[model samples]
Target: MLTDVKRTPGEKAFDWLNLIIVLVITFIILYPLVFVLFASMSDPRKMFDSPLLFWPKGFNLDSYVTVFENKDIWMGYGNTVLYTTVGTFINIMMTVFGAYPLSRKRFYGKGLFTFLFTFTMFFGGGLIPSYLVNQQLGIVNTMWVLVLPGAISAFNLIIMRTYFQTQIPLELEESAYVDGCNDYRLLYKIVLPLSTPIIAVMVLFYGVGHWNSYFEAMIYMSDRGQYPLQLILREILIKNEFKDMLGIAVDSQYADRMIVREGLKYAVVVVSSLPLLILYPLLSKFFEKGILVGAIKG
Candidate 1:
């Protein structure tokens, strides 16, 4: 049977305080998103006239229409989807392969390998050297440059290794070996099936990283056609904002162009963030379990 417990006066006071704090924080986080959404839909003239945006002043879909009609935006969307999908796959595979071996106690020179990997977390050869190295590898200005150079992340590798060590039992592996299972068979059949939480977490991590990445695309790609969605959006924002500041117009109608330009900023933010926002909810249950289990020991 369930019993009701009475709280002390101090406890009750603390609960109310906590609730107030949480509400404040929630408002802080949600206000910007709400403001952006309303502003994007509002008429630009009204938006400029009003400092506060509790609701749309005058509803319009022109911003969304303009954004959707751009050829560069569509092309960039396709390229971003491809890059994020392929890059995340490679990231997960490389992280798993690197982590599995390092997690094994019997692996030779594991300490040395771990040290070398960890060293990278604190230090690097810097951008110039990295760019030079990529140039030497004949990957510069190529799609491979985006994926290959960052295939493995040291922090993610450590997390995976820790998860494998803590969650996977050595006795299970021994039992599998006795049943004539090889290393590859044990990994694929036994280990991976039981690692759904960690895998899901890794997928979310790598996928979001690849999706939001603009710096890599900008640095590596010279071809505008090959640019990712973020890069293209950045270009559009800069072009529009610059044109507005300089009183230049692609069209003779200056007022309409400015309205579209202002609204496009918020529209771009929403569109770019939409994929991850949708994705996180689907993986949230696994994400919680994965982070807790993976972080518990290490």
Candidate 2:
């Protein structure tokens, strides 16, 4: 049975204060997303006129239509899909392989290895040196540049190693060994079967990173044909290359490049972020448990 304890007047006041602060923070955080969504669907003229968008002042689908009809956006979307799929697969596989061994008590040089891995989380070869190395590797301007460098995130590796140690039963490993199961067999047939939650967490983490990444892609990938959706979106947003992207019809009331760009900007935000928003809810159930377990020890 659950019972509620009576609160003092001061405690009640603190609770109310906390609620107000949280509400204010929530509004601040959520307003931009809400405004962008409303502004994306709103008529460009009306969206421009309205300084505060509680909702769309005038409903319109022109921006969405313009976005959907663009060739570069479609090409970028295809490239982003390819990069995200392949990159996330590499991230999960590499993270799993790196972390699984570290989690085992019998692994040699774990202390030294763990120290080296953790050291990287704090320090790295600066951007110019990394770029030089990749240039020498001849992967610049290629899609592989996006996936290969960030294959194993040190922070995520530690979290997963902790999860494997804290969550998976040691007795299970011993039992598998007693049954003459090899390490690979035990991992494939036993450990992995029970690690769905952590794996789901890794997938979401890596998938979102790959989907939203642009800076590295912009630096490493110069070929326009190889650009990811985020890189294209960056060009559209920062360069205001709207005329080339949307090519708004002169006959339309909102054809003015300035007018179209406002709504178009929000639409691009929605399009770029839609996948991540959709992904979170699907993995929400696993995320809470997995992150907690993974982070508990490390």
Candidate 3:
């Protein structure tokens, strides 16, 4: 036989308070995303009339159709996919190569090398100097400019280094050496297999960074053909907003175009963010484990 125990009044009150707080926080976080989604599908005239939208007034695919009608959006998608794929590969390779040596106990002058790497994080030659350097190297206005300059992130390097040091046993390397494995073999075959979590985290980090980046493309790329998705989306949004403003100023008859622009804005946001929203869920398990184990453990 089992007996039921009653909860204390204080504990019940605390639980209810905690639940309320969590609900409030969840609402605060979710409302904007929900609002944007509903607003994009809603009739733009009705949306404007009612600023606070709990649900879509009239649902339609007009906004998405408008987004897809642009040829630039398709081009941007292709270019962004290319940039993100190649950039992330280079980032992972460079980060791993840089961090591995630092993690090794046998590597000489590791402290000095670590100091030099960390120094660049806090200080840099500034934008003009960097641009001048890129110009001298003839990488400006080229696809290489996007991938090369930022191939290795210092923060990510440190995180990976710490992961290797803490998670990978020194004895494992010694065992590999005894099995006639060279440094390269040990790294590719052994270290890499064991470091899946951190590698996945790096992929998510670098991939998203390259996917969402516009500033570098704006500064380095003059050709519209080479522009990434984010830069192209920015151009489209700005052009739409400008047209809306001009139309509103010129004639009241053009006010419908303004409403269309409002819907288009939220549609653009949804399209741009869709990839990340999909990707994060797939990587979430590894992401949490990697950050905690790699960053906090060491």
Candidate 4:
């Protein structure tokens, strides 16, 4: 009963080629992640023996337990959650409001505003100047330093503006206007209803950026208690671990502990990555249509 599908020889050939290319690309991207999962689950000793890439040998959750036992790790987790959640909310608000006006052709000084936003995408005040500004504002060493300074990304604003202009129909806004719905009501009721996909994209982008950020915290926050997850992970994985990398001598008890702690590094990766990995599937569901709407539309 259904007969809309059609394919020519050339199309069939192209489809086969595309499928092969896609599978190859997927494997390339996933192989390292799969290796990390194996490394996390397998015995650290066994990992050194065969050096796994595809699967685990003697799977266990001990690494997870080790990661969770660290008080610093838990504190970092809590701080990261706070930063990511609050940052995403602020990002959405700023992006929506910033983009909405840009999308409106009737707005005065629209070109000037667009140019100003675009200018920031290419250049910024250097780290020293930015640090001084934060210090002057009294946000240095404070939690607000993490959330407020870089709340609205210019690229994300542009993407949202493009999405709003392309996907949300002008006639829908006109209809609302005729119904005596003001600009604010039209945006809150109508524009936002169709914007779930784009909003999800922004949330994923901003949330991941905020969660993984460490350098900002290292510069802005002098207090270890206020440090986000990535900064703590850096201290453990890179700074401490680097000292032992030149083959820690077997005679040193400290070296043995450092090697054991190396296993803990793998555990930390799995721990910090788990939240974003869980979030990715949900976020990916919104990406397909959102990318097309935001990118391909006139």
Candidate whose lDDT is highest: 2
lDDT of each: 0.87, 0.90, 0.89, 0.85
Q: List the residue pairs that clash in candidate 2.
A: none
Per-residue lDDT of 107-222 in model 1, one digit per residue for the tens?
Answer: 99989999999999999999999999999999999889999999999998888899999999999999999999999999999999999999999999999988889998888899
Q: Residue-wise lDDT of candidate 2 within 92-152, one digit each (tens)?
A: 9999889999999999999999999999999999999999999999888998789998999
Query: Residue 210 lDDT in model 3?
Result: 96
From the highest TM-score down, the ranking of the candidates is: 3, 1, 2, 4
TM-score, candidate number 2: 0.92
Per-candidate TM equals 0.93, 0.92, 0.93, 0.89
Q: Of the candidates numbered 1 and 3, which has the greater lDDT value?
A: 3
Clashes of each: 0, 0, 0, 0
| Model 2 misplaced regions, further than 4 Å | 1-13, 246-255
TM-score of model 4 relative to the true fold? 0.89
After superposition, the stretches of candidate 3 with alpha carbons farther than 4 Å from their true spots are 1-6, 239-253
Segments of candidate 1 deviating more than 4 angstroms: 1-3, 239-252
Regions of candidate 4 where Cα sits further than 4 Å from its true position: 1-21, 241-256
lDDT of 4: 0.85
Q: Write the per-residue lDDT of candidate 4 for residues 252-283, one digit (tens) a residue.
A: 57655654565678878888999999998988
